[model samples]
Structure formats: C-alpha cells, structure tokens
Target: MYLHLTGTHLRLLGSMHLFPTTSRRTPPWIAEAYDWADTLVFESDPPTILPLLSANEQGSADRLRPFLPPDAWQHLNAVWPAGGSLAPLAGLRPWAAMIVAPTLFQQVVEGVEPRLLRSALTQGKPYQYLETAEEVAASLDTIPLDAIGAALALLMTDLAEPQRTLERMHAAWLEGDLPAIHRIALESPMFNLPGIREAILDARNRAWAARLTSLLARPERTLVVVGALHLCGPNNLLDCLAHPFEPVPDDAA
Candidate 1:
C-alpha cells in the first residue's frame, strides 16, 4: 500500500523517520534526495527495478531476499542487469533519484511477526473488515433493527473506523476490484474529494508536476522519478512537455 502524503509533508515525514537511523544498507539516494528536496513526491505505482549487484552476488540474497517477495525475486532474475554492470541505474547519477511505493509493508510485518496484527487489533475494533464471499452470501440473513442505531452512530463520529475502510479499499484495488474501490468510497461518508484516497493521489500528482515545472524552466539538470502509469496517460507529464517524445515499442528490443 502506498503511503500518500503531500510533497512537502512527505519530505518532513521522511526526514523525521530517517534522522535517528544510521543504517547504510539501502542506497543513499533515497534519503539524500528526499531530505534535500523542496518537495517529496510519492505515487501509488512507483517504479521498482531490482539492484543488479544484489542479484548477481548470490550470497547477498540472504540479506536482499528478505526485502522482496518471491514473485518479485523471480522477476528480478528475468531482468538481471548485465555487462554494463550498474546498467539498472544508468542515466540516474548522483543527483538523480527514484522512489518506490511502500508495497510490502504489510507482508513484511506479517511475515516477520504475527504479533503486530494482534497488537493493532487490541487497540479497538478494527476500523473495517472486508466481507468475505461467505460473509457476502451470508448477508442474505436479515439484520436485527436494534443494530441500526449503533451503525448510524458510527457514521456520525470521527471515532468511526476509517483505517479499516481504507484497508478494505486498498485490498479491493489490489484484487482488481476497480468497482469495489469506488463503491466503498462512495458508500462511506467519511471519504470525499479533499480527504479521500483518490483526492490524495490527485494532490500528489499536482504537487510533483508543479515542482518539475519550476525546476525544468532552469538550466539545471533534474530527473524526477514517479510511477510509470503517471507518466503515460492523458494526465501525464508527456502532455505537458513542450517537445514531443516518441514511444519506443517493446518488441523493438
């Protein structure tokens, strides 16, 4: 799941998280650019190419393997960077940076320690939980009218479960539930234009676009990395480009 934050807010948040840690394992580029930037942009679908060095040196798998899922590792093998060695990061130099969305946080947490979930649950009722197919089918049973008052109370308060709802929507999206995301969002009164997940994505795109627009106007060289999807569609940076860029066919390789 992507941690959506405003560009400026993201920089501030990332800085706070990194300040006390001295671990040097992950590439320095992430923290370096993140800290120095006037804006820190995040995307729902950030690019995530594997580090070739990590793959080639089989011994490093014990360390790197923990960070990626098995499926991602398989893909890494298929695209293992060769010859040029550091070709995976070519064109991206000292100042150029890339950001990957936070996808495996849940999986990593669950895999490492099942207790994390129990702890979160102990806090209170989880904001929301998805109805399984069995649960959906079971809805055929009628609800007692007595529970309706409590349900309506939840809809009116800030204490109403939001994190649970967000998780459900995220799960739905990941499972190819395009309609479910929209359905859940529309059904919940708590989520809306300025505060909903979609609104957060929209704000993130506009924030990064404005930053790039200002920087590109200068003579300085800048490389802003965002999700591949954001760069391709009608709302893409390509549309905003003054010069045209041709598409390179995948088969041409």
Candidate 2:
C-alpha cells in the first residue's frame, strides 16, 4: 500500500481499525512504511475515552427503557447483558454504539492506524488528520436511526453474519484483493443502507482526497493511513484526488 511519487515521498496505507487477534504485532511492511516516512496522516485523531453515561443521559439504557417497548427493551438487555463487555454500548449514542459494537464483539488486537498512532506518540512523530470531529459527526448523523437500529438488530440476531463479513474483509485486505475489498465494503450492512454510501464513504473520500492534494505539495515524506474500504469501490480517494497516484513495486532483490 505504499504509494509512490517521483521526487516526493508519500505512502498511502489502507488501515484496518481492528486487527484479527492472530495479528498481535505490527506487520513488517507497515513498519517499513513508518520507518521511511517523516510525517504521517490519519483519518482522525484517536477518539477521546468515552465517559460512563449518567441515568439522565438521553442515549443511556435508563432513558431508552421507557421509549422502547417492553419486548424491545427486553431484547436489548438480553442481547447485551448489563455485566457483559457490550454493556458500555447502552451508554453510547446509536452512531457511537454502531461504530464500537463490532470491535467489541471481535477477537481483535490494536489495528493498523492505532499501532502507528501509538508509535507516533512514543517517538513524537508528527501527524495530522483528514477531517475534524465536527465533519465526522455530521457524516454519521446522516445515517437514520432506523438504519442503525436495523443494523444493530442484525448484529444481535445473527452474530455469525457480521463476523463472517469482517473475516472476508480482513482476508481481502491482507491479500491485496481490490475487487473483493470493494464488494465486501459495499455489501456491509451500514454501507448498504439507503443513501448511506453517498453520505459516509463518498463524501468523506472526496474531502480526504482534497486534503491529500494539499498535503502532497509539501516536501516531507509522509504516510497516509485510512480504512481499506475508502480506497476502493466508486469514487475512491485516489480517484477523487486532483492527480493520480502510483504504487511502488516490490523488486526481486
């Protein structure tokens, strides 16, 4: 995933937000990319630690108890036991819950971006992000509550389904299978929801491409890491960029 530019040093890495548990350490290829780059770019800063929700909080299960029907509430509690690891989700907004749930459910390790971010923090390697917090919030808000509810319901009812899809995506990414990556990303529940593709993936890809366009003008060798999904399907980040990017080839040496 190292993007090559003559007379400039810029690498684009498609990152997995959560790595399979089997991958406990940074892959050598990723380490090489980090070693070569003087600067780094990411989708966003690591989010702030989530605070425990108070009883009066709108998104808390305490408030949701009265709003959802008895059977619905029962199902929620049953699916995510109060003492279970998933219990914290009950305190998050639907959007936040949707994002965190898969990672919580998975047997995973710190992923590509997080691993790099940690190293950057330890070494004091400077970095920046494509979008601000508000822009991310605005994009996430476009996903209807019903869409989030249905997606969550899918996760609850058929736990194996999401796990299978995640496995497929991870495998595709590992193998550098672009078509499979695009297919899996487009077919994922959240992306498949109505109008969500345009709002979440397409818009953000365009915006990120614009930012990278600006960043490429600078002198430093930089590494850019984002979700693997954003680099494929229609209107991918590279395609949206003002100029095309070329990938560095591995030699027989």
Candidate 3:
C-alpha cells in the first residue's frame, strides 16, 4: 500500500468508498501546496478484490486493467494537454517512475475465504463458539480451515461500505481528486469486527508506520502511494510524520 515516488511532479490517489473530504470543488490552493512540497507522497492501498490475470507463456505483461478503477483510463488519456492539466500541476515534465506496493494483493491471495469453506462437524449440528484457528481447522479437512474460519468471522461483517470505499478511492484518483479521496478515507464504514477489524487496523498501522520511518530516513522527498484506509484511525501515517503537511479534502476536488 506504500510507494516511493521521485520526480518534479507527482499525483497520488487514495481511495475509500464515497465521501467528500475536500471543500466542494477542486481548489487552486491545493495545487499551490503541491508545488511547495517538492516531494509529493501519496499514501494509499488499492482494493484487493480486483482479480489478477493469469501469466502468459511469454509473460509480456498481462493487463489487470479490468480489475482496476474506471478512472485510470481517464487519467491515462488526460496526460496530454487538451484532455487535462495534470502535467502542469505536477510541474515535472514526462513524470518519473512510479513505485507501488501491492499490499492488497498479498492480503487477498494469502487471506482466508470463509463462505467457500465447509465445516466437518455435521452441518446441522450447532456449535456456538469457534474461537481459535486450530479448533476450526480440526472441524474441517481443508488447506486451512481454521484460518478461513477465523478470517471469515472478520471479513463477512459489514464489508459493503469498505469495499465501496475502495471503489470510490479509485474513482477519485482517476479524476485527479485528492480531497474527495480523503473524505472517502475518513468516512468509510466502521471496520468493527469482533476478532478481525481491530487486528486488521493494528496490522495496517504498523505497516504504514514502518513506511513513514523509512521515508524519514531517506534524504529525497518521495511520493508514496498506498491505501486510503491506512491514512485514518489513531496512528495515521501523516500523524506519525515528524514534519507538518495538510490533507487535501474531498471538496477541494
């Protein structure tokens, strides 16, 4: 969910469902702020639900575009003058290389899937408590029944808003709306699963904190791309920084 961006100009998109974080429209001051930062870092995480493409025999870069946001297409088209003004706003001409960490990829591929899993204890039998991973694993004959059971217990509750927030994040990014992106991050549904939500939040906070620590060590001002969700909660990345920076609100977009 973190990235290292080095260039004269940069645009980073953070997304979470739908909410207006900025004033009501894109503000000129935000663009001016980017000009002052010198190094533009975007902290965001792409949603993991997007499917990965199967590798080709030659492996000539298969496109996972379909699994990406609809706005990416627009942004790609806007790089030119008539389409939009991202180039001027960035101040960096052709743009430098963009670095991204597919954190969501790791989470989705490695995380457990609860609905598809089956319990070994007869379906009709009622078992109230399924606490630990091993207890769930013992009840089934699968790759990792316990893990899936535990993960499902967390992912199944109130996921609609989180997922939508992710989608909205992508949309705002494509449209070059950082403020709107921030709104989505702050207002997305509460991730309050008994055994899962807090764990996920804590894990995310550690990951982002680590990134900030590393960035603080680096001399170059770099732009970081990560998930919008990582920006909120108690220990937010911006909050952890030694220096000061302002969050672009959704209304500004």
Candidate lDDT scores, in order, read: 0.31, 0.69, 0.34
| Clash count, one per candidate | 1, 0, 29
Using all chains and alpha carbons, the TM-scores for the candidates as numbered come to: 0.24, 0.82, 0.32
- Candidate with maximal TM-score: 2
lDDT comparison, 1 vs 3, better candidate: 3
Order the candidate numbers by TM-score, best to worst.
Answer: 2, 3, 1
| Model 2 Cα lDDT, one tens digit per residue, 159-246 | 5666677778888877777779888876677677765677778889988877777777778888888888887888888789746567
- Give a tens-digit lDDT track for model 1, residues 162-214: 44454565455344344465567555542332232222233344444555445
lDDT of 2 at 76: 56
- Steric clash pairs (candidate 2): none
- What's the TM for model 2? 0.82
- Clash pairs, candidate 1, are 128-164
lDDT of 3 by residue, 135-251 (tens): 222222112222323232232343344445555665665565656765764563223323223343444455555555555555543344344554555555545543444444544
